[model samples]
Target: MLCGKGLVAGYLGAPVLHEVSIDVRRGEVFCLLGANGAGKSTTAKCLAGALGLRGGRVTIDDVDVTAAGAHERVRRGVSLVPEARHLFGRSTVRDNIMLGGWTKSRSHRPASFERVLEMFPQLKRLLKSRARDLSGGEQQMVAIGRALMADPRYLILDEPSLGLAPIYVDAILRQAAELARQRVGILLIEQNVGKALSIGHRAAVVETGRVVLSGTAEEVAANPLVVDSYLGGAA
Candidate 1:
């Protein structure tokens, strides 16, 4: 559903990603695994149109979006849940989620909000509560729920489990897997190899801004190099 071809991008003047490429097929969870600063987030930003690419191209369902702005990408069904769960601290949970559907018409928002509430029942219960009062895990749910509010066909998630407890992390990963089963293509950027591998349909390992490995989850999980590099030789 989404494809990045030979993407080269960076900040300031120095390049962090070089010729990195990956694809997320329809109904699949494609996880991008790497150490800190391996350019996973940069790749996500490029795909979401949050960062402009210095080279290569990004496409969604065959439409080139390399130069499209973030909001334009959203209108084309690309939604990103960034690394930091950027929720409005002063806004109520409902209000925060509502902002995600700002791209949709007013008549369409109620149905979208209902869908989000169904996907995240916890958020439904805290609709009137302030975002700042929620726990980290709850806030993460809000972030995901907020993205779902946009009704995206392809969801780009960067570090969804970054700071949560094990239970919440597991919950979020399972929810991500469920989303894949529902045919929502996901580009999941994660530093947590084990959890990402466990839930991902396929995995790509990025090293120094390049995709060094790519394959099905089982194939990657059992790879000796992947085991040595990221899985601690457990595979």
Candidate 2:
């Protein structure tokens, strides 16, 4: 399991996450739902080691990793697909995906590349294409493929479907579900509350930098707070 206990983090001394705690068990999709400025992305960064925690304990399988740097954490089987699917516009899709294998041995890359292609066959055809030329959905696929190159045990996806077509959104969320089936713990932060809960085994709602509600996806979907606020009162 990937767990963050009593997390406290922020930018420039202003705390954005206040004692926020979460757990992502292997083979399950753990959704984090919240409005803009609710600190969902901040929590992802902290868990993925891209941002430092002011106070907290991050553990994977009961091993402490709170002080580890981003690279170190990646080496320890953690990966992040940041919001907006940050891809190298000028770089080839192949190069962009290969970048994630920096932590692995050179010989391991070919097999990893093949595995990613198997997960996203369309990318195989776009390997030589520059990232900037792909549609929004394709760019997002590359972002996820890049992260998969690391063979992460825990993957954090932040707003992965934010600006995609509905079909692409379904594709992205389906991939998340597939990853969970492969026993990869998934920490998913998304704005599409209903769709997210549909695939999530468990979920939490964050408000004003704190976790306001959490439970089985069904229970969360049934909560009046979630229904009225995020699901338009019909969840």
Candidate 3:
């Protein structure tokens, strides 16, 4: 499990999150749903050790890894696929995927690459193609394949469905569910509540930097706030 307890953080000394806490369990998708600048990405950054905490702590299992740097956190089994796919546009897909295995020994990298390719066979044909030339969905798969190369126990994806075609969106979320079944805890940050809840076993709504609502998918789907705010209905 990856957890944050009363996390407080911000940019340039200004607090963006206030006493936020969250839980993500393996074999399940813990979806964080909210609008833009609702601190969803900030929470992901804090949990993934991409940001400094002003207060509170983050943990992997029961061990406090609050002070660890991003690379250290990756080695410890936490990986984040930030929004915008963040691929090396000019780089070949193979090179980009290879970079994700930096934590592994040279002797074991081939196996790791194979494992990721198995999950994304489409990438196999594009291994030598530049990322900038691929479609948005293909790039998204490359980003995820890269994360898998890291052998992460917990995967935090930020708005993966954004700007994707319906088919690609379903494919990405389907893979998310598949990953959870394989025992990877997924922290999916999504602005599209409907799709997020569809695969999410549990979820939370982040409003103005606080976890105002959290429960199983069924419970969250029934929450009046969720329906009113995210389901395209009147409050």
On TM-score, the leading prediction is 2
Can you write out model 3's per-residue Cα lDDT over 39-140, one digit (the tens) per residue? 999999999999999999999988899999999999999999999678999999999999999999999899999988888888899999999999999999
lDDT of 2 by residue, 1-235 (tens): 9999999999986799999999999999999999999999999999888899999889988889999988988988889999977899999999999998998899999999999999889888899999999988999999999999999999999999988999999989999999999999999998899999999999999998999999999999999999999999974
Whole-model lDDT, model 2 = 0.93
Give all TM-scores, in the order shown: 0.97, 0.98, 0.97
Write the residue-wise lDDT of candidate 1 on 152-230 in tens digits.
8999999999889998888888889998888899988877788898888999999899999999988888888889988
lDDT (0-100) at residue 83 of candidate 3? 90
Q: How close is candidate 1 to the true structure, as a TM-score?
A: 0.97
What total of clashing residue pairs does each candidate reach?
Answer: 0, 0, 0
Computed on alpha carbons, the lDDT of every model, listed in order, comes to 0.90, 0.93, 0.91
Q: Cα deviation of 214 in candidate 3 (Å)?
A: 0.3
Clashes of 1: 0
Clashing pairs for model 2 are none
Off by over 4 Å in 1: none
Clashing residue pairs in candidate 1 are none
RMSD of each: 1.0, 0.9, 1.3
